[model samples]
Target chain A: MSATRDLVGVAWTGLMARKVRTLLILLGPIIGVASMVGAVGLTESAKGALQVQLATLGTNLIIAQAGGTFGSQNPTLPGDAVRRVDSVSSVTSAAATTNLSGVISVPVQGASTYYEAFPVPVRAADDSLPSVLQVRLIDGRWLDSADRVLHLRSVVLGSGIAKQYGYLPGETRTIRLNNTNFGVVGVLGKVPLDPTLDNAAFVTQWAAQHVFDTNGKPNELYIRTKDGTTAATATVLATAINLGGPDQVSTQVPSNVLAAQAQANKTLQKVALFAGLLVLTVGGLGIANVMSISVIQRSSEIGIRRAVGHSRSKIGAQFLLESLFVGVLGGVLGALIGIAVVYLVSSLEHWVVEIGYGQIPIWMGLALLVSVIAGLYPSIRAARLEPLETLRLG
Target chain B: MSTQDPADPGPSPDPGDPTVQLPTATGLAGPAVQPLLELEGVSRVYGEEVEIYALSDVSLQIMPGEFMSIVGPSGSGKSTMLGLLGVLDLPTSGTVRIAGQDVSALDDPKRSRLRGQSIGFVFQQFHLIPHLSALGNVETALLYRDIRPRERRQRAFEALDQLGLGARADHRPVQMSGGEQQRVALARAIVTEPLMILADEPTGALDSANAAHVLEIFAGLGTPERAVVMVTHDPTVADTALRKVSMRDGRIVADERRVA
Candidate 1:
């Protein structure tokens, strides 16, 4: 133990004797570890945000849309497609909706004489739309089966449209669309995953078929699978709905999209890790170079120690410990700086900062190992020096 | 004390036998008075293609309590002889024995251990680690020993104090004069209480005053269980020893006993 303490003292003194050189040698590893931590933290936070967003969107939901070109002339899903999807064993609920683009006009607030028109996307959805889309009604009740059966001219305005038109729930307003006036019944809050949904208008399927002449067909279908089923159920539903074959319809599962996104993130992380390793390699080389130079400069001191009966291995261990010390110091400083950088970025982006605290040991361990490896050659060189020759040279 | 008297020489003992004891005129005979160091037909050759015999067919012996000096001009292989005696290098074709143990056959680590246990070295240049304190430098001699830190420090302190540098224990080599640095080196050398002390031109860099002081210190370290061997080129320093050996062309030409 005393020998070890003496070795550490001697190594530390050697480093402290040349302050500028030691500091310069330390910079490489410090920068390498700091950037590595920062990159890892940044990637982790992004992945966390993505996971939260996916959870908010509900993983069980899948979207099926008419395949091929999308335009006014393209054929959409038949009216019975929703019924066909609902009949699938794995599907719990399904809703079909057709989108239409039109202009809407409303009287200026507190100035009934003036009118303003804005282009808006309109969605015609069944009574099951709320459950399938997981949308929340902020102002009034959602559409019921009676509203669809009665073919009532009722509409729900998205929050953005409501704010634009100065419309409120229970306040009857005429929304002119395709030369027909529809009465507004409710307004929806912002949807978590789909930002575009906040600018759309919603109406019943019967009203859309009668007023817009959509022929009881829908361009989009939203489905909720049973508790354990996933995108595979979408394939089954697609095959059942599109009796014609695979090319006639398309299916999408949000979880699958998230999986692809996570895969891309993994690739990015691997690249970042490679870059980090490259930087660390440069840092390791710097340590090796410094240790080599130290060995040469301290050759006489080494001879003195050897003459006093220090073994070659002891001399080697002293230099190795010096390099290891530098590496550990760099690791600590880099970790702090990296965490700070992560915090600053997370704060600016309003992301939940996640710095896997468990990885701290691994990072430091890696740094130490790298330093040992870097110091190996130089330490061996120092140990191979002949005490007689060194003393004679001096 | 007696000066040199030409006594009849005894038969040489077999070099390979560890039990053999050679006769000496010191009156302290038997196994207890055995020579502390011995070299038998030692030779050291350097360079591969162009051979150079740094030391050739050299043989010498020093008993306990003996203060001996090896005086030679340059190229007389004094340094090479010192290296072999200190176990810093092995003789190419001969045996070196310290305290009755054959050292040339030992491995590097064992050789180092033997040197640490039995031999102390004082160089001409006072090779003290520049960054370590005087006490720290002295303590380094016992770093590999099985001693505790507190004891190591205490012993090192005592060694420094004995050299009259107790108050300067915390000073670095750069902060001390040449004589003080050499004293610290001496303190380091003696901290282990080795059987033999080897001084290689110890006062080569000192003035006459400092040299005399160092010689006085060396004179005070002689004991029945310990020996001091100094290699020097200065005849004035050589005269301070009780016995002296002059070397020429890697061979001892004169062995004289001035004081006994």
Candidate 2:
């Protein structure tokens, strides 16, 4: 008997019966939100994951003495200060290592003394290197403590290094790192981030020290502070140790690297926030306009209802309900599509995509709010129409 | 509820005894001799660039339960007068009293309510809602009341049954014959049980047979409790009314009684 119920009945009948037109009316926001959600998701994920990728060296690492520029082609982290950091912290684990590329000679059949050889990059770690920079071994054991003192020609070649020398685990092959021969002890799996590391052999500190002939402390220090000590605190501690030391060797809490990473994250998060807001604003306005226009067109139906005893508010509510239906549908669908795209992208590549700690939920909520407001304004307009005028115009 | 009750003597005295009976076709159910509606100086003005007077100073009165007809040429303001009588339109200046209440002074919503409760409308176009069935079109008058859905359908069926249209209840306007559709329209008009039925060219949309059938139904509706007012242009149709009046330029030109 109340005006609104009948209006709702009338609106519901028309909308439900005309399914395609209703969906077409809602299309603008759906497509817009989908594109916006997917793009923003991918960009933020790529930025955040980059920081983690850069910080994989697990130790409190600091470099000095201008070996190379930061985030550059040749040198961000120095290779010589690894030992100095070990002496600074009692529980410290450190190593100095450099990348080398040279051929390793192997005697071939019918060759009396000389042999054909192939070139490869080499890396030498300190005795405590395994403790400082861990390797995920595919096969064979790491170089033992005895391998450092003996100055033995023993080495651990990476998978690429093994492939270059045509060698595998338990096989005999020699690789010359900086013109020094070292026996192949093992092969590691592919670390695509550094092709140089992948192709290089792991040599002991003494062999590398004797070969390179640079006993000048390491180019950088990679130290492990005791647990419960902040990376910043450890860096502070290292700075304190280096400030008064003769070597000018600095200590850094590796956590600053993580902080640097998160700084990038913060900026990316802000960008994602802005993108989401833009989508919501535009999408909301579009939905609101469309809903309002439809309400205007249906004013005659509204008049007919009024003449039949429908109230003004009832007409308004019917329109509002239609708007709300659109909003809820767009929101849930946009979120689901956003998360699905993130998943597909992450799986096919090395990307890290997380929907929970990011703009996805916020955007979805905004979309929902937009949809609600879209319905709300039209509802009010419909409710305010005079039954008398409506009937006349109709 | 027998068709011929044994307790009710059949046309007592058969017009043979002075005090016993009346021999009129609708004897006991016939209309009382009292006016049910009165309009004094009813005028409707239409204003555009220049003000056009649609109806000016129209006055008329209809006795309760009498069959009345209003005939006029095109642009004669007959529709305007009927609109005022039905409370569908307000008089620009004048008084319209229905059942002794000055309805022109009542507020718009109250007037509308009064029309819904007391008057039924039958228009030339059949005016049945296209989406509704014949029965549904008839049932629209009961929507504003608190009657239940099943009861509403029952009453609608009863009205259509009286029009001899019980079989056409499920048909739509397009599906029914012109005669059937108009009979359905007539059924719809009387379904609300209003005090008076107003027809604006009820037979204007129908052929001769359908128009005759609609006229017969209109004639049958004249009784002691309800009255009928129909607007027409045809003399043959106007001749069917118990009383026929003529209008020209919003004023009555003639008023007369049918010879039976």
Candidate 3:
């Protein structure tokens, strides 16, 4: 093995001796690996774009309806059931979401306040939930069960609703729901959770119950799993929650919209497989060509080696090892360049581009494997060639 | 003095220029110790249908330190004989014993081991790898063997010193003259301190002056520990060797021992 490595070092010297050919050899695998990585990045971004789009889908969520006795629109899960889902094995978080139609007075300018019409989702949640639905709270704190006293009609407004409510955090404002008056507790800072649900005000389900003053029923029960258990945990919890009599709660993943995007991405992976394989094939061919030509060009050198008692395998390994190296180099460079291109293009368009760094490691490792196989073919041929004839030919 | 001795173990020389065999066959003075290399009835034929006899019915005994030259025409299979003797190519029939080991009977790896340990090679063309400097070229051959890099460096320098090339150790092959490159190649070949050096036309590409310098190096290699068997076509080149043998049509046609 050491002998082989020494030969490879020698072979690489020979390869570097011919830089133009080496560069040409690197082109195919680079483009191939780059395209594959770029496809991966684009697929990743497309999926994320949908996640931002479907942050409003609020799917990947488990919604609670009244035990099939209440039906779709009117079914309301009890408040206690919402807390039970929170403690489930895979459930990282749970929240009760209720919507209340209300009229609010917002300070317009100097003397008067305007009461513009807007309805909002009133979510009563533990603090962990702000991250679960992928919402970013730009300023102020997320709603927590610990701060129950300050919870009276306290609001965390979406970016748009925060603009209109004209009420800042710590400012007193009035809202009327069900003909009862309530005071604003805390104004929600700007956040991107559910765009459809953003215009609505957020208050405790307790406060919502007081303002709307309905019974202890909730329209939706939302739960998010801990990280790394998104799919399996979501499925099991979704299955478990659905068993609450007649599929009253159904589970959804923001990833599902992403998965649909990833289905196209699934197709992209197939294309990537073919592309990566093709890139490797082309890279291998470059290796083969360069090595075979090296054999041709170095016929006299081969003769010298054979005459000096170098085995055929040693000669062959030199050429092959050179190719393998070029392939791996090209794959690495391509992956890097591809990743850079993805990041470059994404930031240029200004969509919320999420090129997940997690996917990179596995695919790059695979590209390296392809390069080794590519380098072997021409090397064997170079090694097996009849030394006498090769030398005589020169 | 040129007449044959009856009890002489040396092969009967051809009538042409049959001089006295050397009185310096080291162990021959005492009870005969093992010869450094011995070939017996070795035959190598290529292809089954219409065989080309590369080497046939050849026998030779090389005592340690003998400067032997095998002179032959281009197709006379001198290279083949060199390959067989060096253990690079196995004889199809008959045995090749190197320092008392029947190397022909060994496995491929063992044959290579014998080639690595017992023999070194120099070729007609200077085969210094273009990428390596002269010193690096010599060191490369030792990288696979048992020698450590430091010792290899020491041995390579010593070998280059033997060829009067120690000062040119840093030069690449292209930078060196043809004679210097060939000398570097010879240094690379003999750095392993093998028992015998098999050179196929080592000075074939050099001018007579360069060739004379290489012949001197080969002559200087004559010592009880090692031997040199060179192949050449020039009679003057062959004459410089202490013992000259000629081959033709895949068989030894002349065996002559020079007085020198």
Candidate 4:
């Protein structure tokens, strides 16, 4: 029948009376909850970043290339491979490219003091490569079908190669390819998915067939499927590209790799949550330990309270209240620490900070549960003490 | 153990001991009044295998306004008798009544409620909770009484101030002297203004000066509406009470009433 407020006050004072022990008890929940929260936060943030990347570049990209090993005759992609892949109902766009022999060098103007220029790889690329690969133009036009059909000496420079040759779009800047001059049609932006393209020089089939004397067959085929059809398109892309020798073509879907990464993240998050709960359980045990010690150490106080008209049950309730208060405090601290961890890690990794704010209350409730469970035995023990005996002992 | 031999019949009550012969409620009180507390043939036993009689067939009555003491050497069972009188323990084979209610028959909560409403206890060690301020410790007695918090605090402060501890009400037990702590304990016991105040070796832990001060306070605590019972082994401490009941071999051997 004690006033609940008074009992709570007593519990509060009891916890405040032993600051160091209380802090030690708080540590378990704090770290446990923090790690759990941080794990979920980091995973979520990474996933969020992945979504943005996927949304812009699309998850339906497929890379198909010749399947021969080194020192063997490398099977070539059919000259009609792009058209064949594009013709598939699920395929959105298709393009192909092949690395041509000999590097392209930017011919230096006389008296220019620029450091020695790095030779750029020259690749025979389709006119549709820019749009299918999601590569934006930083300067001028990409090679068109007209250039390819008319055998024009038009070439495109990636951003790195453009900067090397000091070529601007619309300027008649030319680069040396097969000892013949080719006009730079445009400079492509940096491609995050494929950094090697940043230093490559792209030429249409006109340059490949006329100057290099190479067949117009592409070595690599890039295919884009409609949304939700990448996996299904991947199964048939090899056969669709080279029907006669589907085994000679190897098709890889980059989106599947991303999906695997996401799956791994989900698994890691589960493990983190489990670890967090385990730590929370340990913290709860710590609370019980401290409560037990408090009961024993405060036996005399218990006797005093009993003599002052506190019933046995009231005594138990007081101890339970103390532990509950400690638990709640630990939960709050743990949650705050957890959020801070998430933010800290997310910021360090330059990822979007994503936190499931709704889970905080649940986590705190867990702490309370742990505390009550831990405090039960000690509180009962406190209640069971004989008033007279405890008074004598005290 | 030799001094406590049940066969010795040592130190019988003198012929002038009126209260010793007046054991019944009628003899202790007028026809219209009931004794505040009464014990009828109470015996408390311990041990299941071998019985030990901590208190034996002892009967006594305490009237309001009585300042009394139960004194005995070790193993005389005065502590056991005190426990029964305070309603803290149930007797093995007798009725213990407080304010006309049978304490032994009541369950734990009911008995505890009765005890809380009727009796307050003071200990020799001045058992003030160390973490709480003097006011908080005193307030412990008034809790579970359905009193408003503001009123409870007011009453607790008044009790502390009554015991000349007003200036130290905010101080913790560790910050107080032995005398101050005992005074705080006294404040706690009287904060609820119960029918009886029970003290167990109240001054055993104090110096002579503090003991005298605490005894003086005890001497002034009993009133026409309240009784004060002191249990102690010290002769000087027992002498402070107006009525002295001495026990031996778990039996009341003497009951002497003195005129102040």
- By summed lDDT, the worst window of 10 consecutive residues in model 3 chain A runs over A105-114
Quote model 1's TM-score.
Answer: 0.82
Writing each residue's lDDT as its tens digit, candidate 4 over A1-394 gives 3368778877888889889998998887777777777778878887777666766877878888888556656457878888888889999888888878554455554422232254467888887888888978998889998887777888888888788777766787866675678887788887655656788889888778778888878888888888899888988887888887643788888766665554427788899999999998988888888888888899999988887778988899889998888778888888888888878877888877888889888888888888889999999999999987888821
Cα displacement (angstroms), candidate 3, residue B259, comes to 1.9
- Weakest 10 consecutive residues, lDDT, candidate 2 chain A? A107-116
For model 4 the TM-score comes to 0.82
What are the per-residue Cα lDDT tens digits for candidate 1 across A185-301?
788877644556688888887777777766767878888987678767877766788877533678887576674564326667678767777878888999999889888988988
**Which CAPRI level is candidate 4?**
acceptable
The lDDT leader among the candidates is: 4
- Candidate 4, DockQ score (0 to 1): 0.35
Candidate maximizing DockQ? 1
TM-score for candidate 2, please give it.
Answer: 0.68
Model 2: per-residue Cα lDDT at residue B64: 68
Worst 10 residues of 2 chain B by lDDT: B16-25
Ranking by DockQ: 1, 4, 3, 2
Q: Is candidate 2 or candidate 3 better by TM-score?
A: 2
- lDDT of each prediction vs. the true structure? 0.79, 0.63, 0.67, 0.81
lDDT of 2 by residue, B87-160 (tens): 66678888887776788777655555566666777777665655567887777665545444576688899999
B139-161 in candidate 1: lDDT tens per residue? 88887665556867988999999
lDDT of 1 at B60: 90
